[model samples]
Structures are given as structure tokens and as C-alpha cells.
Target: MSGDDAKRASDAASARDKLLWIIIYSLCSSTMLVINKLAVGANGLPTVVAGAQLAVSAAVVVVMEFAGAGVLGPFEKKRIVPFVLYTTMFAMGLFSNMKALMLTNVGAVISARCCLPLIVCSIEWFFMNRAFPNARSVMSLMGVVVSAGIYIANDTGVDIQGGAGMFWLLVWWLLLAVQMTYGKHLTENIAMTQWERVFYTNAMAIPPTIVLYYATGENELEMEDGEGAMFYLILSCVVGVAISYSGWKCRSVITATTFTLVGVLNKMATITFTIIVWPKDFSVVKTLALIASVGFGLLYTEAPLRKPKVAGAGTSPLGIKH
Candidate 1:
């Protein structure tokens, strides 16, 4: 084959690898949510549980680095601002999500997160000076919103009266969107490998997470019996933190649109797992609505937008250059 053909083949392989990483990350994240629900239901404190997991994952990364894997690296000074902000956003999103899980059903929380793509897209357009392609994108955003509403309306298990829970869940979704966008910016300049990046991010997160864990009066060593609490904790550390981070590294390679789309699918996986494990009371209408919301969010985020053919030319409708 010609050089051009070889380059195209290489590019296609890279894309496939990235997509595989994303799928693994989404599945791992979904599993983390499920394990978290089980652990919390078994009386595990969310802060302590998550903190411990982070600590263990960090240690594992450290060990891998020492083993000549070159998977972790020294933190860069210039990236501090964005790194800290993104890490803080990560902590807040997780804290809010865990709190919401305690107060509401998993399905409801997942449904509420359906709005995240719209939030991310708007943030990119308005705050970051990006633009969408056409009316189709806007309609797709509306579809997600409407679908989320239908799902929520039909959800009998959701405690709308759980005032603080609802508030925190919405806040969690917003923070997640912001975190992803900011994370993208950080990835643009940071030179670390995927594993190293995850290590550094989690490392920075440790001190704050520990403080929160202690402030919440949660004991790290305390594990309830018969709850599979320990197993869940380990799962969160290995699969959730380590593997999911690997997946997200691939995501940071793609456009923010790809990241959001993967996230929406991850939410769907979480919802499906919740239904299977808990067998909650849910309506077909609600189920369909939830599916639709997730579907639309994926569609909107992945929609092919027009791009400028010339570099440094006028901005394309899709906010990207071809």
C-alpha cells in the first residue's frame, strides 16, 4: 500500500483503540455506580468508600511506575490551575452524586444526568466561543430535555419531596459537565501518558478527599459484614478508578462531543444494571423515556457538524476545522 494508505490504516486503528477504551471506561464506570449503591446500602459512607478507593488506586499507579512501566510521572507546575480546578470539580461531582444516591433512586439520578450533554455543549459554545452546526443539533438537545422530563414524570420511586437530594443531584450533573469540559482543556497541554494523568489527578484529589472523609466522620477501616462491602470497595478502586481512568484518557483524545456521548451511554448502562440488580418498580413509559433521553443525548453529542476546510479561516458551524 502507498504511504497515504498506510497513514489512513494507522489512523483507523487508533480510532478503534480509542473507541474500545471508551467502551471499557463506560462499562467500568457503570459498574462503579452499581457497586457504590450496594456498598452505601450496606452502610458504607460514600466519602470514606470513595477516598479509600482513590488511595488504593493511587498506590497501585505508584507501584506500576516503580516497576518500569513508566505509567506515572512527576506533576507539571504550569498545569496546576486547570488541574486543581478539574480535580475539585471531580470531587464535587462525586460527592453530590453519592449524596444523591443516598436520597434518591439510581434510575432517577441517571435520568436527571441526561441534561449533561446540553450543559456541556452550551458551555463550549458560550463560554469557550464554540458553535454548533445547525437546527438539528438544537432539536437534538431539546429531545434529550424532553425525554428526561418524561422519565422523571413517570418515575414513581423518585422522591421529588426529597428537596435537598434533588438539588444536589442537579448540581452534580452540572459539575460533571463542567469537569469534562475543563478536563479537555487540561489534556490539550499536559504531557503525561494516560495512566500518569490519572495518577496525578487522583493524587491531587487525595488530600481533599481524606479531609472530606474525616469531616464526615467516616471510618476508613470500618467494613460492615455480609454486605460484600470490601469487594465493592476493591472493585471501585481497580475497575472504577484505574480502568475507568484509562477509558477517560482515550475520551480526552476525542472531541468533547465524544466524551459527552460516551458519558450518556455510561448512564444508560448504570440504569440498566440498576434495574437488573434491584428490580425496582418502573413503568414501560418511564423506561422508554429514559432510553430516549439517553439516545438523544448520544445523538446530539455525536452529530456530525460542518467544519472549516481551511485552517485559521472563519469558524465552522461545528466549531471545528477540517
Candidate 2:
């Protein structure tokens, strides 16, 4: 083969590897959500569960640091502040998502997540003035909105009509926008590697996470709970680390756009898997809603182009944008 042919083959292999990592990242995240829902929904605790995951993640980072494979870089005052803010919003998102899922079916929670592609774009437009939803995006968004409305009305998923589930979920969704934008700032301005970020964010989060957990009184209560909830909570920690690791690897290989698109598609698989494994009232409307939300959401991903470089942005893996 010609030199050009060899180059093309190498590129194709690289693309395939990235696709495989993306699939792994999606599966880890989606599976963990159902397990989280189960743990918190069963009269367990969200704050404590989040703490456990952070602790496990932090522990892994500490081990990495000891193993000389970690990026325990110098303490920069600039990144520290942003790291704190990012981790705080991240913690809030995690807690609120759990709180919402505890009260509502996982399907409703997943359906609402369809707004992410739109939300992320909206944030970029407002804050960075980078991009906005195009004609195709709007058309695709219409399908997601309509499907969500149908699900909300048809009432396939439970407890959405009443209670604070929708409210918390909305908070979770909005925080996503802030976290993503802040993350871009971190990668571009502060110069933190993915591993450095994983370590710092998890470390910074631990103190605040403890505060959030105890503040909610869940820590005190969960400590008194039965062993089954603890099992799921502990299991969620293992799942969380796996998700983060896969995400870190995937982000190194792909752009934020590709990661988000994979996530949109991942929700479809997650919804299907959640419905199959988790007990829920059967409804065709719900199934269709889940499918349409994800299927149409796929249109939001633009063709493979160079990741848009904003005037003041740096590249980083998709960290905790889920």
C-alpha cells in the first residue's frame, strides 16, 4: 500500500478505538444511574451515596499519586477556586439527581435529560458566544419536547405529576450547563490535565461532600439504616469510578461534542435497560417517549468537525458532564 493508504488505515484504527471507549463510557454511566435510583429511592440516602463515590474516586487518585502515575501538580490559587466551584456544582447535581430519581421513575428522569444537548448549546451561546441551535437542532429538539410532554401527560412513569421531583431534576439539568462551561475554562485557562482534575476535584469535594451529607441529616440516618441500602451505595461507588475512568479515557480521544452525542444516544439504551431490569408500570407511551427523546436527540450532534476552539478555551476530556 502507498504511504497515504497506511496513514488512512492508522486513522481508521484510532477512530475505532475512540468509538469503543465512548460505548464503554456510556454503558458505565447509564447502568450506574439505575443503581443510584434504586439506592436512594429505597429510603436510603443521596448525600451519603455521593460521598461514598467521591471517597472511592479520591482513594483511587491517592493510590495513583503514590504509584507515581498521578499528576499531583503544584497548588495554583487560580485553579483551586474554580475546582471548588466546579466540585460544588457537581456535588449539587449528583445530590439533586438522586433526590429527583428517588421520587420519580428513572424513565422520567432520563426523558428530562434529553434537554442536555439544547442546554449545553444554550450555555455556549450565552456565555461563550460560540454556538446556537441550528435549524436541524430546533427540529430535533421539537421531537424531544413533544415526547417529554407526552410522557408527562400519559403518566407512564410514576410521581411526576406531584412533588419536587421535576424541580430537583431541573436544577440538576441547569447545573450541567454551568459545570460544562466551567470545565472548559479549567482546561483552557488553568492547564489542568484530566488526571490532575480527577484528583483535585474529588479531593476538594470530600470536605464539602461531608458537610452536604451531614447537613441533610442523611449521614446520621443512613448510618442507622439496614444493610441492603448500604450494599447498593457501596456498589454505586465502584460503578462511579468505572464511569469516571472510562470518561477520562474517552475524552482524551474525542471532543466534548462527540461525548455529548454519545450521551444522548446512551440515554436510549439506559432507558431500555432500566425498564427491563427495574420494576415499573408497563406503558407503550413511555417506551416511545424514551426512544424518540434519544433517537431525535441524535440529530443535535453535528458532523465530525474539529472541536470548536473558542477564543479562550483549552481541550479536556468530558469530566462529570453527565
Clashes of each: 0, 1
Clash-forming residue pairs, model 2: 188-314
- What candidate 1 gets wrong by more than 4 Å, as runs, is 1-11, 94-112, 127-130, 133-136, 156-174, 219-222, 276-278, 301-307, 310-322
Top-lDDT candidate index? 2
Q: Which ten contiguous residues of candidate 2 have the minimum total lDDT?
A: 313-322
Predicted candidate 1 versus true structure: per-residue lDDT over 108-166, tens digit per residue: 77566666777777776665556653466676667866876776666644564378878
What is the C-alpha local distance difference test score of candidate 1? 0.66
Per-prediction TM-score: 0.78, 0.73
TM-score of 2: 0.73
Question: Largest TM-score belongs to which candidate?
Answer: 1
Model 2 agreement with the true structure over 1-322: per-residue lDDT tens digits: 9976676566567656766887789889888878888777654667777777878987887788799985677787876888888888888887887788777776577566665766665656666545555576567766766776676566644456465777887888788766765665566567766767777777788887787777777756735364477778878888988886787667566544445556766766676566656747557877777677666655553322235633432222221111
Clashing pairs in 1: none
lDDT (C-alpha) at residue 120 in model 2: 64
